[model samples]
Each structure stands twice: as C-alpha cells, then as structure tokens.
Target: MKKIILYLMSAMLMVSLAACTPTQPKMETTPPDPQVMASTGGASDKVPDPNAEPMEIISVYSKNDNKTGLNQAMDAVDKLTAEAMVSKLIEYGVLEEGTKVLKYESADGIGTLDLSAVPQSGSGDDKLTIAAIGNTFIENFELDKLKLLVNGKNYSSGSIKQGDNDYLEYVKNYKEIK
Candidate 1:
C-alpha cells in the first residue's frame, strides 16, 4: 500500500510540474497602416516635367585653368538655368504647390542647385524632385557633369566635397542623371 501511494504521488507531482511549464507565446504583428501604404497608387507619382530647365554643367579646360573666371561664368549661367527650370516645373504642376528655387551657382565646372521645395501633399516622396532637377540640368547643360548643393554645400556625391557628412553627399556623372 505504501509503495502504491508513493508511486501515485510521484505521478501526480510529475503531472503538476509538466502543467506548470510555460508554452511559447504567440507573436502578434499588426499590419502596416493602410493609409500610408495606399498613398502611392501608380506611375503618375514618378512623372516629372518634360520641359523643365536643363542641368547646368561647368567645364574646366585644364587642371591649371583660372578658377575665378570659370566659377563666375558658371555661376551666371547656373542662376539663369536653375530659375527657368524651377519655373517650368512649377508651371506644369510637376513640382509641389509651395516649391520654389532658392538659389543656384556653378564653380569650376560644377553647378549646385539649391531649392526650397517639398513633396506634394500626397506624394510623400522626394524622388521625383531629385530626378527632375538632375535630369533637367543634364539635358540643358553643355558639359556632362554637375553636382547638387543644398544650402551652402554639396548635398550628395560628385567631384566637389562641400562638407563632411556621409548621407548628405550625392555624387553622379552627367550621363547618369537620366
């Protein structure tokens, strides 16, 4: 009788221990916001102004060329071209409503465009702005190279190193603008 009771008690204890062990919790993942995901519907989001001003390209004939003369000429041309391009884009509704051209200049065969524009209300992406600015200048400029500078320095990669920020640097060849 003692042996049987002991056996029963051991079995009961084992059963209780097994029941007390915790099970893996189910992972709960909520789906992304529907409104955010549904914002971009189709190809219209990627279209830019076809007649926007071309990208400005400065040319340095030689490594020993006069930097001041080259910069002055490039700056004059860049200012005009940038203004025209931004105006055209805005007129065609390709740019956002409040978008505007803040300034532009070229130095030693490098043109930098500064814009005070933001994506449209529903666009939610600045890719179109980037494409438009790069492509338009490349198409309109004589040289095949340029750089984009926001504020007072280069925004991305190119030949010019305006400052010391990694993500802010955007470099591209003129042929690669399209």
Candidate 2:
C-alpha cells in the first residue's frame, strides 16, 4: 500500500510538471485577402501615423524625432477640397507660407501636384514638408502615389528631389481615420 501510494504521488507530480510546460502557440496558415492588402497599401499600413495638422480632406504629416510623423491628438475638419486642404497646411507651416498649388489633379488613385514654392532650407523641414503634402493627398484620395511637380518641373527642395519618373511614397505611416 505504501509503495502504491508513493507511485501514485510520483505520477501526479510528473503530470503536474508536464502540465506546467509551455507549448508553442498554434498558428493558422490562412492566406491574406488580396483586396484588403491592396487597399491598405501593405507598406504604409504597417503603422498608423496621424499628425497634428487640422485634417479636412487630409492632414499634413510632419517628421518627428522618430520620423513617424504622427500624433494621436489631432482634430478633423470636413468639406475642404484638396486645394483648400493644401492651403491650410501652408497655414500650419508644413510648407513655405507663400507656397501655392499651381495645379492639382487626381484620378485612378494617382495625384499630380504642381506647386509654386516648397521649403528650401533645413533638410528635415523639406522632407517633412514634402511628406506632409504627399501623405495628405495619398490618405485622402486613397492614392497609390503622388507625382509632385514644382513650377512645371519635378519637385526639388533641400536634400529632397523627385525624378521625372519618381512618385511620392507615404512617410512610413498614415493619418488617423475620423
């Protein structure tokens, strides 16, 4: 009886030990939805980055210390067209105060933005300024990309410049959805 009790005790101890061991989590091999992935723009959708700019059609996203260009604490406006949105961004100091959109057009998820002025000093400012504008249009229009033109030519400011074939990509994150 003593031996049987001791064996049962050992068995219980082993069972408890086995139960305490960690197991690998089960993973599903389900394929991703093509439409969801495509619509989200896998690269830009990796993170959500809303900035402080007042968003109507779209808000500007400025580069922060982390280069994230996002702030959770921002407000959203409505009813502004794309051109008016850019004007508001200028008011917020994302672009040169006197900058003007020479032309703005978008169709089929592609936007062509022709501007009169862009930030020329401070590489950081230039990058964020361009990023703010491009990101604004991209998010609002659900665009694949924005082709930036300055004074009928490709955009160039500080250390930033776009080639004839180049298009603007998201600044690594997106604005908050209101």
Candidate 3:
C-alpha cells in the first residue's frame, strides 16, 4: 500500500510538471542565412516577400503648364493632407522645392495650412503659388477655403481674407486640362 501511494503521487507530480512547462511561440524554423545575418549585424531583419503585390497609391492632380494633369502619388492622406497639398503645388512648378509644411488641420469646415522653410517670392510668384494651392485643394479635396501661414504667422494678404483668415480663391488665369 505504501509503494502504491508513492507511485500515484509520482504520476500526479509528473503531470503537474508537464503542465507547468511553457510552450514556445511559433516561428520560422529555418536557420538564418550567413550572408543575410552578417549584413544585418548578426540579426535577421524582416524581409518583404518578393511575391507580394505592390502597394497602390493615390495620385493627386495639379495644374502644370497652364493645364491640369496627374501629379505625383500622395505621400500622406489624412492628418498630413497639407504636406501632400504642398507637394502637389511643388509639382505644379509654383512653390519651391524646400518649402516645409509644419501643420495641417481642419475644423468646422475651415482648413489651416502652416508652412516653414518657404522661399521668398515676388508678387507674381505669390499669385501663381496661391492659385496653384487653391485650385488643387478645391478640385481634389473639395476645399474652397484655407488659412495659410508662413512660419507660424498669418500670411500678409489684405485682399484675400474671407472672414478672419486668408481664404483660397479661384484664379481665372489657371486653365485646367480636359
């Protein structure tokens, strides 16, 4: 009877030990390639599957050469909409390449476009630049109004304000391609 009780306790302990042992997470069983491991400082990086399909990107339209055309694909969509907008303006050949969009937000049907690192422009360039921005936003995002800022300060445009901020208006000289 003593031997039998010892055997039963041994069986229960074995079962409990098995239950306590942790299971390993599922991972690729293949050993890391020597060349790949060496290139990544002895660590394997997540490599994109060669068979995967390319990601689809949305292309925004812009005015170029006095006619509208397909511009570059959008770099951002939601919160960074102003960055994409400024990029489209650059694509339109109006805004300079180094212009930086600091912030972009929309509230109560009003959109704010804050910019920095923008190049100084003459009156002619400013007109063309504003028109390019206005037409693109109006045509693509259905936004006819916007508050533009340069380096956190309001743009000095006395004639362009609608209510409290400078609003984007349509420019008759900019012709859109059919």
TM-scores for every candidate against the unseen true structure: 0.36, 0.57, 0.48
* lDDT, candidate 3, 1-178, per-residue tens: 9999999999999999999999998998999977655555433566777987655243444435543533333543443356766775666565778788898777666677777844445434445456656665554555557776777887654333334545775454564323
Per-residue lDDT over 1-178 for candidate 2, one digit per residue giving the tens place of the 0 to 100 score: 9999999999999999999999999886997877655564557666545754554534555545564354322335656566676666766667767778788888888889888877677555566667777777787677899998988999886577678899987766543211
Q: Which ten residues in a row have the lowest lDDT in candidate 3?
A: 67-76
lDDT of 1 by residue, 1-178 (tens): 9999999999999999999999889885888776657657577567677987655444211111321111111222344366666665555444555666677666654556666653433331233344445555554553344555554455433332335332222223322322
Instruction: Per model, state how many residue pairs clash.
Output: 12, 1, 1
Task: Give the lDDT of residue 109 in candidate 1.
Answer: 48
RMSD of 3: 13.6
Q: Rank the candidates by lDDT, best first.
A: 2, 3, 1
Q: TM-score order of candidates, best first? A: 2, 3, 1
Residue 11 lDDT, candidate 2, scale 0-100: 100
- Candidate 1 Cα deviation (angstroms), residue 68: 41
Pairs of residues clashing in candidate 2: 50-71
